[model samples]
Target: MSLIAWAIGLALLLIFIFALLSPFEALGWWAGWGKRGLEPSPPSDEEMAEAQETVAPYYIVYLTAIGGVSAEDISKRERVFLARLKEALPDAMIVTDVFPFSVTNNPLNGERLLGWLWRRIHQSRMKRSLKGTLFGSLIFLRNLLQVAVSADPRYGPINNVGVANEIAKSLVRHGYPLGSGAPIVVMGWSGGGQIAVGVARYLNQGLNAPVYVVSIGGVLTDDPAVAYVRRLLHIQGSKDKFPSIGDILYPGRWRIVPHSAWNRALAAGKIITVDPGPMIHTGRGDYFDYRATLANGQTHVERIVELIADFIRPIQDVAQPA
Candidate 1:
């Protein structure tokens, strides 16, 4: 064989091997390999003492989207939304401890590598036009693989269990005992909304406490957990395409014949859906953007925060001072 032919054959073989092994590597990372350091540790004595002293009427657990936890990881809209939430509920303690389930921080993970490559390619000015088409394709493939692997019954349960336990531990570490009767609110964005539902269920079943869930432009599936939640508020942007992906990826969410658990929940008023028109999937178009005007002559951020405060105030025994 010619030297060029041998080189070509060897390159093809290596590519094939990588393609096969990449999924396994991604799956392994999802299964919690090399991620221990990122996990939240138990709160210290001082932290627990502080928590006990300033225990608020409600606890707000904020779960970020893919690759989002810190301010740097999130967009300006998310940061603003969080700030407004805190401002609106002065008595509630906001917990930003939940980590992203996917392999976002790990530089060595195969999924992260793929994401890095895609970002690099999409960012180049030469490929600006191609970026939208190619990047969307890459994202679709990534989301599909993630749903196929991580959304399954076997592997998916582990993530919820871990997150639930972390939440419980965090409560205990912060001096909130199990079954403390303190109301817990979970706010999840994008994919984190799925995790919030799972965590709510676990908290209800395992800890004997129900939690209020707020899904902001998040994709959701029907889970028995909805039965155990105190209330579920799903805020979807009219222009947001990300949340609709759940319908495509998980058809059961939209099925009418054999009503999915989510459908049933909606029917029973256990879940409430809010459509804030003209909002996009991310950034300034989300619920947080002060620039986005609402029909009521208030900014989108202002109106949404008002809605949230109204929803939460009635649930709490001690209301915030007007």
Candidate 2:
């Protein structure tokens, strides 16, 4: 055989091996590989300013979706929602970008890819295995390269730990009474919701502080850390189908026989589900557009913020002194 033929055969063989190993890779992430970490840094000046305005009875740390890297990337609609949330909860500081650092520079961040593929599979109405296979392959390639470079896996529980540490340091720096039993709300949208669960678990274990998690259109998978949260509020739009993809991929949340972890959380009153009838997965039309509002009295964004404010007030009130 010619050299080119040998190279082609080798490439095909690798592809076949990758396909066979893909599912195992996806499962392995949850089982083990998604546990690497990076060192945490003190909250930056901007982060401090964002969270310092009012030392409210409750501290809210808002984690954005997968592509939301910085506050500057937040859209006008989102800004409006944030402003309304601030007005309604004047005593609280709604901190965004709680995790300011990206785990790896790899364009193929596995967690983000999982979210994207899950959404696509759902939107296309394809079978769940399609998402599993594609996500498995993507994660395999991503981790394979990371291992090749002797670098840590960028998207995993360890990233959650780093972000949680930063949040803890910020609360301490701002004098938020970490172990004083103050209410800590970790709110996340899309993939951030998964991170929120990890952060909640970290705070509960490391600081022994109770945490409340609010997931808005979030894609979630089973994580042992979820049990650490005192309460979980899941807000989903009736029209939004993307967030449910996690349930399909992982067989929890919406399953007929819910996963044991989720079932236990629900039974223990650690989970609450809310469906806002008029909302969609993202901005105005498609995902991430954020240009227009739904026809309801308020935009979907506004409504979500309003709902969050309403749900958190009682918790905050209970924490406040008479």
Candidate 3:
């Protein structure tokens, strides 16, 4: 075989192996792997502004997109978008340090053995190389598997609760008073959506708080946790077909499945679907792209922040979890 063919075959083999092992970290974490350092490292000075706790009407714990290297190493567009979100909702406390991709909250880009590989591929992606786009997809694929695990009936309970506890700890670190029953809104971007829904019940149970979810271009599973969610706001762009895949592949998301968590939420009016209009899942024209301007002169991020900020502001509910 030619060198190109050998390379292609090797890549295919690696991907197969990667997929097989994708669930290892989550499963291991639940099985007590890496239990010692579950708490995330202390934030740097740059992150302290959003890391500290404060008395606010709402506590927003953000889950970065699957492409994240770490909670702190999100995309420039995401960084700008999040900063803009904090500015838009000064009354809300935003905790951006929770890395939901790992049940133990360990970043893929941190001190792990594969951290260097992730960094190299991530940098290639930053340079917009074809090689980067191809290899960087491994990050997306791995995180997507974690989302599936969170939706899987067999593992969802154990893993989601573990992740929820990790998130609760992060919230406490950020100054959240556990058992305060302060409303907790999880803002999930991209693959973060299913994760947000997957962990809602546990977050509510752990913190005794009213748990809400706000998903932007998130591919959500019809996880049973949706049944316990206080409310959900799914923000999808009109042109983004990525989210539709969740419905296409997950039978629970189908209409005929009347008792599915998704349908139940809809029947009970607990889910709100909003079309931000003319947005893609990611990249140049996606929701967080500050360069994409509408005829009204607002960037796509600005427009989305305006919509989400409005819904979040008047939420002063003090309901505790059952």
Identify the candidate with maximal lDDT: 3
Better candidate number, 1 or 3, judged by lDDT: 3
In model 1, what is the error at residue 256, expressed in angstroms?
A: 2.6
lDDT (C-alpha) at residue 47 in model 2: 52
Candidate 1, pairs of clashing residues: none
Give all TM-scores, in the order shown: 0.71, 0.65, 0.89
lDDT of 1 by residue, 1-322 (tens): 9999997897667555544553454455445664443344344455556564545666778777653423134556767777998898887777765553543323222245365664554344225476555444443344334333335555555546556666766565544554566778888877777777867877776666558998888777655566668889888877888887777766567766357667777778888888867777665657778897977788988877877777788767552321
**Model 2, TM vs. native:** 0.65
On the 0 to 100 scale, the lDDT of residue 41 in model 1 is: 34
Model 2 lDDT, full chain set = 0.61
Give a tens-digit lDDT track for model 2, residues 1-322: 9999997898678766754543433334334554433334444455555554335577788766654434345555566766778888888767764542333221232255455653443334324376555544433343332221111223445555556776776675555654566778888776667767767877777666669998887766666567788888998877788776767755555547555577779888888888865567664643223444666645565667777988888888787731
List model 3 lDDT by residue over 194-309, tens digit each: 88998899888766788999999989887889987888999999989999989998999999999998998999999999988799998899999899988788899998898888
Off by over 4 Å in 2: 1-54, 100-155, 252-259, 285-296
Candidate lDDT scores, in order, read: 0.64, 0.61, 0.82
Poorest lDDT segment (10 consecutive residues) of candidate 3: 36-45
